[model samples]
Target: MNPRTVLVLGASGLIGRFVTDDLRARGFRVVGAARSLAPAQTMSALDIELPILALDTAALKRFLGKHSVDIVVNCLGVLQDGPGSSTGAVHRDFVARLLQAVADSGRAVRLVHISIPGTADADRTAFATTKREAERLIAASGVPYAILRPGFVVAPSAYGGSAMLRALAACPLDLPETEMATPFQPVAVEDISATIAWLAARHIGDASVKAVAWDLMQLEPVTMAGVIKQFRHALGTAGWPLAAIPSFMLDLGAKIGDLASTLGWASPMRSTAIAELRRGVRGDPSAWIAATGIAPKTPAEGIGRHPATIQDKWFARLFLVKALIFASLVAFWIVSGFIALFVSYRAAAGILIAHDFPPAPVDPITIGTSLMDISIGLLIVFRRTAAVGLVAGIVASLGYMVGAAILTPDLWVEPLGALVKTGPAIVLMLVALLMLDNR
Candidate 1:
C-alpha cells in the first residue's frame, strides 16, 4: 500500500495519542487533532510531526482533499457535548459526520474506528449509545471500516501513579463482598493499534477492507478491584487508598465542571470512567487477538520500561487537583455574591412597599441599571483588578437596594436589612481586595 496518511480525531486523548504513535512508528503518516492546547503541546515530544488539525468538518474536509489520505483512523471520542456546545454531543455523532464526509468523496477509504467494548450493546451505557450510533452510521454509509473495541485499558505506567491506582494505592485493598460480573481483559494500546494497522491494510478475501468490531480484550476479564490491585502492584506501591467516587459525586463533579472549564479543566468525572469505577466494565477480545495473532503488553512490562510515565501522570494529576481547588474558591465567591444580590434586592423591595401590600413598577431604567451592574459584576472572576469588578457589582446591587428604599419610605424592613443584604458581596470584595493588595 502507498504510504498511508491517517487522520485521528481526539488524537490528544489517552488512547488517541497511543494510536497516533503506533501508526506513525509503523511508517504511516498521521495527522491528529484535539480541542486542547496542553495535549497538543505534549504531543510534539512524541517524534510524530503531524500537524494538529481542527476537528471541525469543514476544516477536515479541506485537509482530506488536500492530503488525499489513504486511511482514516478515527480515535474520535466525546464526553456529552453538543455539536459546538458541551452538554448533549457524543462521539458517535462526530464519527457519523466523519464517515459521511469521507463517503461522499467517493475515494473508498479504509476506516479504523476505536470504540469502547460495551458499545456493542446499544442498551447499557451512554458512551455506547454514541459509539453504537457512530458504528451504525459507518455501516449504513457502506464504508469499509474496522471497529476496534478495547476493553479495560490498564496502563502499567498508571500502576501506583494513575489517579485510579493512587486513589486505591494508599490503604488496605478491599474487595466487595458481593462483586458483579463485569469481566474485562485490560488491553494495552500497542496491541490494539497493531491489530488496527494490520487490519486497515489487509484486504480480506470477503472482508472488503471493512470488518465489524474487533473485541480487543486483554487475556481475561479483570474485576474492578482486581485491576485496582494490578495498578497498585504495577506502581510498585502498596496500601492502596480506596476513594469511592460515588456516581452522585461524579454527577456533582460534572456539574462543577462548568466552572472548571473556564480554566481549561477537562471533566474528570467521565461517565465511562465513573461507570468503570462503579460496577466495572468488560470485553472479549478473543476474536480480535486470533485474527491478528498479536500478544498484548502487560501493564507491568510497559511501566517497567517507562517509569517516568507513571511519575509524570502523578505530577500532572496533583497539579490538576490544585487547579480544581483554586476553581472551587472562585466558584464559592461567585455563588456567595449571587446570594448577596438576591437577599439585598429582596430586602430593599420589602422596605419600598407602602401603598397597600406590594409595590409597583420600579421602571425600566432601574431594571436595566441592575442588569448592567450584574453583567459587569461577572468580570470579578478575573484575579487581577477583581476589586474593580466587585466594587462595580456591589455598587450596582446597592443602587438597586437604595433605589427601592427611596421608593418606599414607610416599609417595615430597615437599613439593617440593606446592610445584611450587601454584607456577603461587600465582605467578599473587601477581603479579596485586601488579600490582593497585601500580595
Candidate 2:
C-alpha cells in the first residue's frame, strides 16, 4: 500500500463505491474516477482517504504519469443505453481507450475488471457484449488482470423506487403459490468487494496475471418462486398474489421498459434490468474464494451495506424538472418565431395593400407547416438534439403565435419577455448552422 496506487473507474457507482472504500481502508491509495464532478466531490469530502479522478480515458495516461498505480480497476458499468445512460459505446470506447493507454504507459501492475457472469453464448445483450469485449481487451493488453462476476446483489427493501414491490405490498390478494417454492442465492456487496480486494493482493497459480471468472454466489440456491414469496413476506403482502409471467411475456416487458426509458430524465427501470431479474445465474465462488480466501457474504448480511437508495419517485421528479426546462425552451422558441413571422406578414401586407398586390394562397399553409414542426419538438426533449430542437420549436411557436396575435385576432402576451427568453436559443441555432456550414 505504500507506493501502490489503485485507480477505480466509475467510482461513484454502488459496487464501485463499496470497492473503493474497501481498498482505501486496507491502506491502498485509491484514485477514483466518475464522469461528473459532483459525485467526485462527494466521495472526496466523505472519504478523504481516496483521491478523485474525472472519467476521461484520454487523460488517463497523463494522470497515471503523475501517480504510480499498481492496479487499474474497471468497475464502471451501466444497465442503460450508453455511457451516461445504461452501458453502450461510452462504456465500450472508454474501456478500450483506457486499456490502450495503460498498455502504452508501461506502469500499473494488473488490471482488475468487473464482469457479469456469462459466456459469449449466454446473453447477447449489449451489456454482455460490451463487458465481454472490455474483458477481452484487458486480457489481451499484456497486463495482469482478474475478473469477478457476482450473483444477485440484494438489498433489504425497495430498490430503484421499487414501485412494483410497493404495488404488491398494497394489494389485497393471494400470494403466488408456485414462486414461493423456488430457490435463490444472493451475495453481499461487501463480500464481493472484499473478494476483489483480496484477489488484488494475491497472485494465484500460473502467474498469468489475468483471470477470467464467474463469481458463483455463496448462498444455498433458492428458486424464483421462493424469492417472490420472501419478497411478499418481507413486505407483509400476505394475501398478495403473483402469476408466473411467461418467458415471452417477460421479454415483452423488457422491450417496453426499454422503449419508454428515455421519456424522462431518469428511469427507475432500465430495459435490460428486467431480463436480469427474470433470469438467474448461480456459480461456485469456491475457486475464487479459496484462491483469495475471501468468502461471499449472504444477502441478509450485505443488503444494508449499499448506501444510495433510488426510488421511482425520484426518477419522476428528475423527469419533471427536465421536462419543465425543455417545455420552457420550446415555448420560448415558438413565441419568438411567431413574433418574427407576424412582423414579416404585416410588412408584406402593408406593401401589398399600398400597391394593391394580390395575396398568395401558400401563406396560410406555410404557417400551418411551421406549427406542425413545433409539436414534434417534444419528441427530442430528452435527447442530444434538445438544444437545437428548441430553436426550431421557437421558430415554430413564435411564427404562429405572433401571426395569431397580430394578423388574425386578439391574443395578447408580453413580447419583451418572450424575446429575452428565446433570443439566446435563436442565436444558438444561428451559430450551430454556421458551424455546420463550415464543417
Candidate 3:
C-alpha cells in the first residue's frame, strides 16, 4: 500500500468514480465508499483495486478510526433531493456528522468537498442551497478543508445534464432550440479528478488554499447550443438541423415536466432544471489555475478528446428506447384496467363468473382488480414506489395467468393465444423491475 490513504465518499458517482481511478493511478491507496456497495463492486472489472465500503454514519466512523486515512474526499451529492434522499441530510448534515466523527477520532483528515457554481445566485435551488450550507459547515469546523466548486463537469458516460446535452445533439427529430445562447464554462471530469488528486498529495495545507474554495472552470465560455453542436460534430453526425422554438414553449414544457414529476416521472425538463440551465454556469478559473498550476481543458477540447465510441452512440440512441418502454408499460396497465372496468365490463364479469366466482360478487371483484391494475400502473411510474409497483405487477400478472389457466385451460392454446401472452407480460414486469435500480 502507498503511504497515503484516501477515503472517497460517493465513490460510485460520476465524479467520485473517476476520482477513485485517478487517485489509484497516482499511487495512493484509495478506499471507495458509497451508500450501496454493488455499483462499486463493478469497478473491480476495471482492475482498480480499492476497498469498496458501504457508507453510514456508524460505519464511516468505524472505518475512519480503524484506517489511517490521510485525506477524505466527499463527492456525495444529489440533484433532486426529497424524502428518501434529502439534500439537507446528505449534503449539509452529513458533512457535519463526518466532521464531528473525524474530530472525535482526533485525526487531522484533510477534507475535500465537491460543490458546484451558482450557489451564490439569488435564485438558488435546493441543490445549491444545501451545497452552500455544506461549504459553510466545513469552513467553520476548524478542520483543514478545500471546497471545489466546479462548473459543468463533463464525463465520457453521460447522466443528468450531460445526458440531456447528448439527447439534444443526437436527436433525430427536429427540436426547437430554446436558450441556445446560455453560456457555460465546461470542465472535463478527468481534470476535476486530477485536481482532487493533486490536493490529496499536498494534504491541502497550503497557506493560500486552506478553507478556500476554487471554481474549476474552463478557459473559454461556450454557448449551450455550441456545445451540443460541437458534440454532434465530434460524433461525426452534425447534419441534424435545429429549428428555433419559442421561449414560451420551453417554459411551458418545463411547467409540464414539473407537473409530470408530481405524477412520478423523473423529467429533467422540470422548472428548477430549466431555470438552472438558463442561469448558465461561468466562473473565473484564475484562482484554480494559480493554486494548482494546471490549466483545465476547454469545452471543445474536452469533447474532442472523448470521441464518440460505439457504446456511446448506442447509449445515445437507446435513451429514447427506455423512455418508450416505460411509457408503453404504463399505458398497457392503465388501458387494460380501463377496458376491464368500463369498456368490457360485461365480458370481465362473465370471465369472473366462469371462474366459479359468485354472480353477486363478480362485479365488485372486477372493480377491485381494475382499480388495483390502475394503481399498479401509477405506482410503477413513480420513482419512490416503482419497485413496489413492479413487484405487485409481477405477482398480479402471474396470479391472473395461473387463475386463468385453471379456469380456462383452452385459452392457452387458442388461436388468439390470450393466456400465452401473459407470460411475456410477467417477464416484462420483471425486466422493468431490474431497470428501475439506480445503482
TM-scores for candidates 1 onward, in order:
0.63, 0.60, 0.81
lDDT of 1 by residue, 1-439 (tens): 4766776666655677777777888887776656553433354433233433335566556667776766777765654442244322446556655776786765767777877666444345565566677777777877777887776665422311144444444344443433323454567767767776786567533464466777776675566555555555645554544444444555665466544344333444444444544544566667766777887765555433443345544543453344343344455545554543565666433433334333446333334444565455455555444567656755765665575566554332664564445556566555544443210
Off by over 4 Å in 3: 39-62, 119-123, 172-178, 203-205, 244-249, 252-267, 350-372, 384-439
TM-score winner between candidates 1 and 3: 3
lDDT of each: 0.56, 0.55, 0.76
Query: What is the C-alpha lDDT profile of model 3 across 1-439, one tens digit per residue?
Result: 4668888887777788788878888888887776555543556433233332324566567778776887888888866654355667778887888887776766777888998776465547887788888888898988888888888878876766787777666675433454777777788898898888888777445766567788898877777877777778777678865566577877887786666566656666667787788888877788889988888887678887567888677666656455666677888888899999999999988876776777888888899999999998888777778888889988898888887778767667779887788889888877777666433
Deviation from native of the Cα of residue 361 in model 2, angstroms: 27
TM-score of model 1 (CA atoms)? 0.63
Give the winner by lDDT. Answer: 3
Write candidate 2's Cα lDDT for 1-439 as tens digits: 2646777776666566667777888877787766543333355532323222233555677666766777777877766674245465545777777777777776646777777764567665677777778767766767667777776654333334233433333344322443333244666666777766765676434363365565747746765444434444444454645454455554564564565455543433455565555445566677776676666665434432232234433332233233344455556445534643565656534433454335674456545554555443453344556545655655754675566556543223445454344446555544433322100
lDDT assessment of candidate 1: 0.56
Index of the highest-TM-score prediction: 3
- Model 1: weakest 10-residue lDDT segment is 155-164
